[model samples]
Structures are given as structure tokens and as C-alpha cells.
Target: MIIAVIDGMGGGIGAQIVSNLREELPTYIDIYALGTNSIATSSMMKSHANKGATGENAIITSVKKANIVVAPVSVVMPNSMMGEVTCGISTAVAECEALKVLLPIMPEDVEIVGLENKPLALLIKDCIKVIKKEFNIK
Candidate 1:
């Protein structure tokens, strides 16, 4: 399966996701790191994503080919990530047929009720759990 992990800013979250997926998933599963900037892509690559790309076009094009798309909730919000996520990027992700596994992290002004306040690491673990179950990893 091809999984695209999308992130912006420092790409720390994407890198962590890639690293954990690399360690926990089967070797045949392909992980693609899609970033809003080159630094973000590079960081995820260092974490061992099978492939990496940067910019809105890259993300828009790549997510369509993935079986699963993983990202922070902010990724779907146009102009988020300090305007790094364009409308096209957000639309592409939203319209894609791939299953989406989005972290609960969001802008300060946005809130989703009934969600536990968890650390980033814990959220990622939970994200992985969902992916594993949805993909029937076991």
C-alpha cells in the first residue's frame, strides 16, 4: 500500500509519522512524504520515507495516487500553515478517494469537542493504530 504523509512548518510531525510507520509497518508498504516545503520533505526523507516531494502541486498530485493520506487536521484548511497550504492542496486532499487519517491537531481558534487533549506523540500512536486496523495490517 502507498501511504502519503503530509505536513508543513518544520515537518517534525511528518518525520515522526514516517519514522514510526517505517518501524511498525511491513517492508512492502510504501510511505511517501509530501511536504509544503523542501525542508519538510527532507526531514521526512531522513526519517526513511520511500519517496518525498514538496510544494502544493506535489502534494496535490501525490495524494491522488496514495491508498491512504495521513496529515494534521489543519492540512484540510486552506491558507493554514501560514499560507503554505493553498486552496488547491486542501481541495485535492479532500476530494481524493484515499482514506484519510487526520490528527486532531488544529488551529488555536478551532476546536473539536469530545476529543481528549493528548500529546503529539500519543496522537500519532493513535493514528497508527487506526491505519493498521483500516489496512488490516495484522
Candidate 2:
């Protein structure tokens, strides 16, 4: 299965997710890093994603082949990530056929009610759990 981990800005979140997945999932599962910028892509690549791509077009095309897409909720918000997320990028991610595993994290201006505020590490752990369940991994 292909899991696309999308992130922008410093790509730290994506990197952490990719690293955890690499350690937890089977080698056969491919992790693709889809970053809004080259720096983000590089960060995720360093964390051992099977492949990496940058920018809106790359993200738009890559999500098609992914079985799962994991990212912060902001990924679906246009103009999020300090304006790194474009309308096309957000639309593509939201409309993709893959199962989306989005963290509750969002920009300061947007507030999602009724969701517990968890630390980044805890959120990522939850992400891994969901992915493991989907893949039927122990």
C-alpha cells in the first residue's frame, strides 16, 4: 500500500509521521512524502519516505496513487500553512479517493471545536495506530 504523508512549512510533522511508519509498517508498504516546498520534501525524504515530491502539481498527481493520505487538517484548507496550501492542492487532497487521516491541527485563525488538543507526538501515535489497523498490522 502507498501512504502519502503531506506537509508544508518545515515538514517536521511529515517527517515524524514517515519515520514512525517506516519503523512500524512492513517494507513492502511505500511511503510517499508530498511537501508544499522542497525543504519540506527533503526533510521527509531524510526520514526515509520511499519517494518524495514537492509543490501543488506534484501533490495533486501523487495522491491519486496513494492508498492513504495523512496530513494535518490544514492540508484541506486553502491558503493554510502560511499560504503554502493552494486551492488546487487542498481540493485535490479533499477530493482524493484515498482514505484521509488528518490530524486536528490547524492554523491559528481556524478553530475546530469538540476535538481534544493533543500534543504532536500523541497525535502522530494515533495516526500510526489508525494506519496499522487499516493495514491489519499487529
Candidate 3:
């Protein structure tokens, strides 16, 4: 399966997800870190993503062909890093046949992690669990 991990700036969101997936996912699944910038991709790459891509166009192109798209909550909101998400990533999500899993964060305009009180990583872990079960990523 092709899993796309997207992020904006520091890649903390994508990096964290990538790191966990690397440690927990079976070796057969493919992980791609899709970043809005080089810094984002590089950081997630260091976190052990199998591959990385940066820039809005590259991110869009990569995500378009992905089977699953995992992004931080920020990726759904407008930000300076990727020059607003509506026309880029948002459009891709609207058009592509990819399954998206968004993490919980500030501002509240995007999707929440939806769980009992827990840390972000743990919430994300649960998110991955659902994704794995749904897709049978093992």
C-alpha cells in the first residue's frame, strides 16, 4: 500500500507518524513523506520515511497517486508554508481516491482526533490502527 504522510513546516506531524509507522508497520507497506517544503521532507526522511517529496506541486502530485493520505491538522488549514491548502492539497483530497487521516491540533477548523483523553501520538496511533485494519496493511 502507498501511504502518504503530509506536513507543512518542521514536519513534526508527518515525522512522528512516519516514525511510528516505520517501527510498527509491516515491511511490505510503502511510506512516502509528502512535505510542503524541503525542511519538512528532510525531517520526516530522517524519521525513517522510505521516500520524501517537497513543494506544493510535488506534494500534490505524490498524494494524487497515493492509496492513503495521512496529514497533520494544519495541512487542512491555510498556512504560509504551502501558500494556502485549498487550491493545493485540499483540491487533491477532493479529487483523488485516497483515504485521508488527519491528526488533531489547534484552530479547530479541521478534523479532530476523536478519542478519549490521550496524547497526540497515542491518538495518532489509534488513527493508524483504524487505517491498518481498514486497509489490511500488514
Candidate 4:
């Protein structure tokens, strides 16, 4: 299966997701790191993603082939990630055919109701649970 992990800024979140997936998921699964910049992509690449891409067009094109798209909710919000995420990138991710697994991370000036404030590690573990269930992984 193909999984895409999308992130921007420092790409710390994407890197962690990639590392967790590599450690827990089967080796046959393909993990793609899609970042808004080269620095972000490089960080995730160090986590051992099978492939990595950066920039708006790269994200738009790569997500199309993903079986699963994992990212923070900000990825679908235009002008998010301190303006690193463009309208085209947000539109592409929001409209992609892949099953989306978004973490409930709110950006500045945004608030999501009905979600408890959880630690980042806990949220990431929850993400892994969803991935495992979706793919029927042991």
C-alpha cells in the first residue's frame, strides 16, 4: 500500500509519522513524504520514507497515487503553515481520492470543538491505530 505523509514548516510531525510507520508497519508498504519545502522533505527522508517530494506541484501530484494520506488538518486549509501551504496544495489534498487520516491540529485563529487537548505523542499513536485498522495490518 502507498501512504503519503504531508507536512510543512520544520516537518517535525511528518518525520515522526514516517519513523513510526517505518518501525511498526510492514516493510512492503511504500511511504511517501510530501513537504512544502526541501528542508521539510529532508527531515522526513531521514526517517526513511520510501520517497520524498517537495513544493506545491509535488504534493498535488504525489497525493493522487496515495492509498492513504496522513497529515495535520492545517494541510487542507488554504494559506496554512505560515502561508507555506498554498491554495492549490490545499485543494489537491482536500479533493484527493485517498483515505485521509488527519490529526486534529488547529492552526492560529482556528479552533476545533469536541476534541480534548492531547499530547502530540498520544495523537500520533492514535493515528497509527487508524492506519493499522484501515489496512488490516497486524
Q: Taking the tens digit of each residue's C-alpha lDDT, what string does model 1 give over 8-55?
A: 999999999999999889999999999999999999999999999999
lDDT of 3 by residue, 1-138 (tens): 888988876888778889998888887778998887788889999998888887778877988778888875566665534464546766675567888787666454433565456687887888789788988766
TM-score of 2: 0.97
lDDT of 2 by residue, 1-138 (tens): 899999999999999999998998899999999999999999999999999999999999999999999999999999999999999999999999999999998999999889998999999999999988887888
TM-score of predicted model 4?
0.98
Name the weakest run of 10 consecutive residues (lDDT summed) in model 3: 106-115
Q: Which residue pairs show backbone clashes in model 1? A: none
Comparing 1 with 3 on lDDT, the higher-scoring candidate is 1
Compared with the true structure, model 3 gives a TM-score of 0.84
Q: Cα RMSD to native, each candidate?
A: 0.7, 0.7, 2.7, 0.7
Query: How many pairs collide in each candidate, listed in order?
Result: 0, 0, 0, 0
**lDDT for each residue of candidate 4 in 37-131, tens digit (9 for 90 to 100):** 99999999999999999999999999999999999999999999999999999999999999999998869799998998998888889998999
With candidate 3 superimposed using the best TM-score fit, by how many Å does residue 84's alpha carbon deviate from the native?
5.6
Clashing pairs in 3: none
* Local distance difference test values of all predictions, in order: 0.94, 0.95, 0.77, 0.94
- Candidate 2: where is the Cα deviation over 4 Å? none
Candidate 1 Cα errors over 4 Å, as ranges = none
